[model samples]
Target: MAAKRRRPAGKGAGAIGCAPFFVLIVVALIIQYWWVLLIAVGVVALTVALVRSTSGPARPAKVPPPPRPQPVVAPPRAVPTGEDLTAQLRAHKRISRVRDMQEWDYEWIRLAHPGKSVREVNDIANTHFARGRSIGINWGDPSAP
Candidate 1:
């Protein structure tokens, strides 16, 4: 003959037993005193509300546009005036009594042959200018000033 066996409690049976115990404990706590549980729940709820309000989500920072380019400054002499300065220039030319000269009349020489010193070139230019010659000056290399 086989031995008889007893069945284990099921999921619903455990929950049903727990339900009665939970109700009895709650009733006992309510009968003993109710304010302690109420105050504890209130405090927990207030703490949760405070945390949510204070530090829940943050927004991204706004970035500004790059600085605009500053306006360029012109030389004081180049600034145009409301009046016409051409008449003044013409009057100044008349007073100076300068004669128009051509490129061929002036000597087409560079300080000396190639690779002259800066002092020698300056002296040559000064000499020619003093003689009233229209100098056709050029740098050896186009890239030079």
Candidate 2:
């Protein structure tokens, strides 16, 4: 029995590559029509030269030397002093103290009574002289039933 042979990658058995054949055809074409190609190339070059020479506006060949690069002046870097940092901290601390306590007082009360509004809670809190925190704490107590 004859052994089977493995074909080389990118080609079939005994196939001639198309590249060499295409190159030969192109070379023969160029040799046969060299004068025509030369005339075409001369025409293109002449057209380009005429177009460039007679372009509408005679533009300045060397573009007016680009405006001298402006000296880049970076902003002065700021270093925060202890006083500035403390002032910022004081401002943020005051804001959080004022806002967080107010929000916390209402958030829990609202959760406990879905239908209760800010005015109702505020009125009730005022009546009992108690903020929502105490009432919410009592409601949250699992043992209170």
lDDT of 2 by residue, 20-70 (tens): 889999999999999999999999999999998885977668767678888
* Position 73, candidate 1: lDDT: 89
lDDT of each: 0.61, 0.71
Clashes of each: 0, 0
Candidate 2 has an lDDT of 0.71
After superposing candidate 1, which stretches have Cα over 4 Å from the reference? 2-22, 55-57, 61-145
lDDT of 1 by residue, 1-145 (tens): 9999877676445556568889999899898888888899999999999987896567788889889999998768865454557777777786554332222222244424357665676667567657555533232232335
Best by lDDT: 2
Say which candidate scores most in TM-score: 2
Instruction: Count clashing residue pairs in model 2.
Output: 0
